[model samples]
Target: MTTSRPFADIDTWVFDLDNTLYPHHVNLWQQVDVRIGEFVGAFLKISAEEARVIQKDYYRRYGTTMRGMMTEHGVLADDYLAYVHQIDHSPLQPNPAMGAAIARLPGRKLILTNGSTDHADKVLQRLGISAHFEAVFDIIAAELEPKPAPRTYQKFLDLHQVDPTKAAMFEDLARNLVVPHQLGMTTVLVVPDGSKEVVREDWELEGRGAAHVDHVTDDLTGFLQGLSKAS
Candidate 1:
């Protein structure tokens, strides 16, 4: 179903970086995941497989793996971030098409991500699209309040001085899109085909009376094309 909300009225577009900005098959995050598993293994004296399971459990329980480690294992956030993002980002090449799309998008644009500011900066720089966003709301800005949390969505709106009704949130994670919908923002789910790492939470799809997502597209290019036509 299409939304009655006019696309022309959207004054701000909040984008989720990382997986949303690029295809997960690129395996950029897999490198980071390998490092995370290594860290968990070395620090906790567990096998790599065990570490992976623990990381997943922590992410589910604490909204973020870092938060879980910090609270439960007393791991320092800075150290964890430094260790995990230490890999080479040479795999991420600039996407001129993505940059062009961002350039053509109307109104204010900002990046909202659960990653650290340093990581966000590096990723955007690697993509050669750092100039597109006006501001970046990183994990520090979220104050450890990760996505899927209503308070995190509220904090994003408050920090940007945005009217929730007039904003649009584009995220790869269906769960993260829920709170934005609840807060009256137009929600778009970017569902790229064959993205194995895209986590699916049944609650996001099965819950009754949930947030009414405005649109779903396989990639940013299609979404941008549709918006351009609508405009």
Candidate 2:
């Protein structure tokens, strides 16, 4: 059970936009997943099956498939971001309860995403929580670098003037929270609720008991609502 006391001192609430903010049953991110595969296939001029293999391989090696493409194939970040993020926001809807919970959190809210600002904005707006976040630190802001990278986390901190010890980070991927945990921020891993049939890899499901992860929750709204007011 999550209690309020542990988070009392945390003032800055940083959240990852995709799987963190909403539940997986919505299949909102699944759209992006399909788009990434399509983009990889078309861009690499390879078969869809081959693209899937390369996508997962690249994602495993690099924090993002885009980074892998950039490093190996000289793909432009702008084009890749534009192509992958052209997903439908129809699957997602306004979650007033989530917005209310987020609004209740003490201090400021920010989004730290490996995606573009446009994609983050679209997701936030579709979920009706765009107003709650003060700013979004996106891939462009981090110079195309993604999370799990120490330098990217440091750059976000420097750019936002955030105190890691006084902040909390909510992310879907446990590996993405490692850098934040190392930097003294409270790391919460948002896992899928398992209410839906979403395909996932074995590695994607790892890190549940990792030392760096401070908390794990399938219900983001409940977790946010349960937090005690920041001291």
Clashes of each: 0, 2
Model 1 lDDT, residue 96, Cα: 80
Off by over 4 Å in 1: 4-6, 195-211
lDDT of 1: 0.79
- Candidates' C-alpha lDDT: 0.79, 0.88
lDDT of 2 by residue, 1-231 (tens): 343326868899999988789786787777878889999999989999999999999888899999999999999999998899888898888999999999998898999999999999889989999999999999999999887789999999999999999999999888998889889999898989988876666787789888888898999998888883432
> What TM-score does candidate 2 get on C-alpha atoms?
0.95
Q: Estimate each model's TM-score.
A: 0.89, 0.95
Q: What lDDT is reached at residue 123 by model 2?
A: 90
Per-residue lDDT, model 2, residue 41, is 97
Cα-based lDDT at residue 69, candidate 1: 87
Report the lDDT tens digits of candidate 1 across residue range 185-221. 8888776465455444443333322346677766786
Q: Candidate 2, residue 218: CA error in Å?
A: 0.7
